[model samples]
Target: MHDDRFQLPADADERTLLTCFLDWHRKALVRTCAGLPDEQLRRRAVPTSNLTLLGLVRHLAGVERWYFQGGIAENYPGSLYTATGKLGEDFDDLDSATGEASFAIWRAEVETSRRITAERPLEALSTHVITGQSLSLRWVLNHMIDEYARHNGHADLIREAIDGQVGE
Candidate 1:
């Protein structure tokens, strides 16, 4: 498949590195679902797991809103997919999931996240969404990188299971 992710610079400032790495992981996740039909993207390829590419996209959309918009910006609208305020709904409630809509929401949230990050300095702080403790933009960026990295691993396995494709 053709990968269009940004390349990590050998040397850069902290902010550049963090944002670029996060973006890299984000693109990697999308790469995992590339060229698959909506049905294939929504298939729980793993026999015993509920995970799907569409579900991952949905989950990350909520996560992008939760951390950047809610945790950092403090707007705190609420969950994107979960209506009853329950967790994992983004992944579990996917009977009607569509690749077009899921990807659109995800891309919009990611763009919002990028805008929020650009407006704040690395040291800027906001109240944590769950704990109400203070959190820095740096921490949120790092955490998001880790979050996407972990989920990208899951996406890789799911993609491989679906079509025998591999490599990030």
Candidate 2:
């Protein structure tokens, strides 16, 4: 409910608005994980779900890599958390994964994503390796906004479950 500095502005252009929203969503997830102990941060806070703050952090890090480096840049630097032929590895092993490492990777990936996008125009296209489909930076930004928005909602519930603290 409290308005933070990360909130997207209503008057911005398409590019500015999209980037701000994505950033707001990113910070929302991080805010949810802030101040919690490593154990609680990594706990499966949702019922019948493998979702955890730490895992979300790792998952987002991989997402950053997949979208920016793998998808946009087409660099294929490899996944951050999941190994080859593995699935959901980011959201797995919550008990042993530490928040510090996860945050470090997540933050770094975000920085890289920002750089990649800043250097390109919204109409710039990138190919998807699996589907051989071309996608524009516009599409990537929209997708990232939606992706982080959904995940941040889950993070909100989990954080509320862990502690009484709650906000956008």
Candidate 3:
């Protein structure tokens, strides 16, 4: 908790620091999604956008899958949701029953990503799908830290709009 290097300790090694961010991001993600009503989860804060808290949950799950499963493992389990831009389309209004499923998928992706990261060496190189270029596991993990942190910020705004909830 005392660490300040992007949620990590200044004394920690590069790998450990990156791991800290990864851990922070996963926890932050869950916190952002917690305790929201179905109606609020589906409500779009922006007047001209399709983004909603529930959709963000699904989107981040997909983001984890595509990055770790598809890009890292080279075998993604397909997508749980498509690129739909309709409000309330994500998880069919984020009701309690369906919210459980959404949480399940998000939880699964977190576990999968953790396993992948732990099993692979930090210096190990893998092919990047979008660029067809190679990058070390270290690089991707660092990038994911950035990715999750950015999305969590977006999530903060959306969650705040839902009921004025704020902070982790």
Candidate 4:
């Protein structure tokens, strides 16, 4: 497999390090779903959790939009997945989800996020979606890293259970 997460430099600045780690985790989610069919991608391996690789992709796309566009960029074009007021629709509507479309949406959102934050200072603040409070870019980056890491852990288990494929 072609891994993009291993290209991190040993001596890098804080933003570089954080963004590299975020990119690594981003690709980790993609890496975990590689070669799997759409049906397999939508499989909820864990009986207790409704999370699927496809769902994660859709969820993350919405999250990327929520934080970057809605929160940080203040674009507020509404959520990509939860626009119907159906919370958790990303995971709930997996039977009709297509892996290719989900991945494309996610990739586009990630690109948009990068563009939005690239020139912004870490201390620059944006209003929160729910709280109407100021949120710094630093907090957003940290939260995104944490979100991806947490979901990627679930993805690891799901992928392994799907075909026994495993790695960081």
Give the candidate number with the greatest lDDT.
1
For residues 1-168, write the lDDT of model 1, one tens digit per residue: 543334555667899988888988898887778899988988998778889999999999999998998889988777788887766678886777889899999999999999999999999999966769788999999999999989998898888988999646
Which runs of model 4 end up more than 4 angstroms from their true locations?
A: 1-11, 84-87
Predicted candidate 4 versus true structure: per-residue lDDT over 52-72, tens digit per residue? 888889999988888888888
lDDT (Cα, tens digit) per residue for candidate 2, span 4-27: 434556666888887877887888
lDDT of 3 by residue, 64-83 (tens): 88777777777767666764
- TM per candidate comes to 0.91, 0.90, 0.81, 0.90
Candidate 3 ranges beyond 4 A from true positions: 1-9, 83-97, 128-131
Candidate 2: stretches off by over 4 Å: 1-11
Worst 10 residues of 4 by lDDT: 1-10
For every candidate in turn, the CA RMSD to the true structure comes to 2.1, 2.2, 3.6, 2.1
Identify the candidate with maximal TM-score: 1
Alpha carbon deviation, residue 66, candidate 3 (Å): 0.9
Give the local distance difference test score of model 2. 0.83
